[model samples]
Target: MKKEQKESLVFGSNLNFLRTRKKLSQTQLAVDLEIKRTSLIGYEKGVQPPFKVLLQLADYFGISIDALMRYNLSKLGEFELSRIDQGFDVDITGSKLRLLVTTTDKKGKENIELVKQKAQAGYAAGYNDPGFIESLPKFQLPFLSRNKTYRCFQIDGDSMPPVANGSWVTASFVEDWTKLKSGTPYVVVTKDDGVVFKLVYNKIEEEQSLLLVSTNRLYEPYLVSVNSIAEVWKFETFNGFEV
Candidate 1:
């Protein structure tokens, strides 16, 4: 058999076993991964996914691509599989964190670009684009540390009260997501949700997700998978505008 065919068989078998072990139906797993049911069915039929999707699945199952592609995970004992899950790194593609993109002044000082309410939708797609970063309005707050990278995001909605709508939240970029403090407010940039400021509860080790809690009692908390998150910024301060 061709190398590609052989590799697909291994991945499909492993994926089938993992999903069944978790007692999750295909539809449920597809929803959790934000993928189509049809595509998931194809994956279980020995069809290899694109590189990005492969990384997403690896993160979703808390396993390494190397192990998923090569090992007969179905044969491994529970203890051994648990070890494999813990051994993987907490990053997309099982690699080091990507370098953060930023804009600086002519004086070589970094500027905190503001993501206004109008620019929120595009922020997720263009965050890494230097042109996009440069186009946003820039300002500096002397009190903020020059050593760390920071960005200002304008928040909307009443989910997090006291901080009213149209409030510009300034936050510092967080590289190591695993170190996120529970109950700390953060600006989490996600693929599906755009950008949201909420109280974060780290559940990466136990469930490979983060529990986002809103301050307002009426709004219910929800879990978002690590793979869907593009960036995390710890809350530094906020500039609320009085209506």
Candidate 2:
């Protein structure tokens, strides 16, 4: 079979499985997505969909487009399926059961993967994909503790002063968000915002959100809903020179 056909097979299977898992019949799902029931049937029979329709289906299923097309969702057990559920799909939550995907060096030491400006968008969508993480530039920071996982992100704007544009911030992964200390700087990765370096104020308890602040007085603070946050990295240190 052609590569496109093969991929469509996976997409169709995933689409059918997800729709059935939600207990919605083809007609019901088609109506909700505003597409014809016949078209939905075609999709389930390995017919390729328009980009817009693919996006609509992915959104309706609460999954990323890459995952919907590439992953074998039907093969996953309940525990593994939960890893890609809505909460985990968008952002890593405070739950201890949640796991972070990472890379390691030849010696089995964890590599500090660098998310460059170009890869930020891809990272947001593919953070859970091991292949995507492995494709990024990876390095090791000897000074950082081996017990904690670390990732480096390249900064782009002046919203946070002192951290210059073009600089890279290496931070430790924050698994338990409740340990967040207000006023501490972090590199927060979100579904909408992509990636940003800010001083985070924990509001998870009170509002199920975080108040992200910028050092530059010109920029106003904003609250990011916990559901949208994909990952949080506590500011351990940075590698950049002042302009």
Candidate 3:
């Protein structure tokens, strides 16, 4: 009846169907997932599991969260669907899947979205929600949209000084960590830090970490492992409003 209810039903039915198709009994599937048997029952009964468990299920079953929550998984192409399960880095754009970063404007044109200061905390949680991403303040910067999809974030604090607090920094998504040039400014979101604008050095070569150097010498550089990063946006430009 309600949207959440509908999604839960779709997810539950899809879970059961996937398990059956994999020829795994409730107990077997539960064991494989390392979750209690009754937990599986509850999930199959339309009670949505926690986000961590949802990720585990998607990884274990080799399916995208999109397909895992679908009421009709058969509609997706085999090749596209199979690749979605390959790894977390699967580029959904290639398959035209809206797994993450569903960029769309009110008029169906590609528009740059803004992550307002108030919206930073929720970005980690709702990044996958098409509604939430679409609802983010949308506008366009013709200069940055030549051939890339950019998202702007309103930042605060004095870690990277002179940029001005409340400045809106526009950035393009960094698909390959290798392409990140050292001594570049980026607004990288990590599992630990919700969001930070930093001048970064690419240490992803020798060590699987990044040297987050601050331009303001008052602050010290720190290391962030490659694995801990959730989203990386290479800084392009910023608009600082003088207060």
Structural similarity to truth (TM-score) of each candidate = 0.64, 0.61, 0.58
Question: For residues 1-243, could you state the per-residue lDDT of candidate 3 as single tens digits?
Answer: 877777788788778877876779999999888999999999989998999999998888777676566434433334434554454432322223233475765677677888877888888667667888878877777665566668888887777876877998988877667568899999887767777899888765334467898888988899986555667788888888532
Clash counts for the predictions, in order? 0, 2, 0
Q: Evaluate all candidate structures by whole-model CA lDDT and list the values in order.
A: 0.82, 0.82, 0.74
Q: By TM-score, rank the candidates, best first.
A: 1, 2, 3
CA deviation > 4 Å runs, candidate 2: 1-93, 241-243
Per-residue lDDT of candidate 1, residues 87-176 (tens digit): 643242212535678988899999999998789889988888888888998988889888899999999898898888899899999987
Q: What is the C-alpha RMSD of each candidate to the true structure, in Å?
A: 12.9, 14.7, 14.7
Residues 1-243 of candidate 2: C-alpha lDDT, one tens digit per residue: 777877798899889988888889998999999999999999999999999999898778777787677656764546445655644442224554347899888899999999988899999999889999999988887877888999999998898879888898989998877678999999998889899999999876445578999999899999987667788899988878432
Lowest-sum lDDT 10-residue window in model 1: 88-97
Candidate 1 all-Cα RMSD: 12.9
The per-residue C-alpha lDDT of model 2 at residue 117 equals: 88
Where does model 1 exceed 4 Å of error?
1-97, 241-243
* TM-score quality measure for candidate 2: 0.61
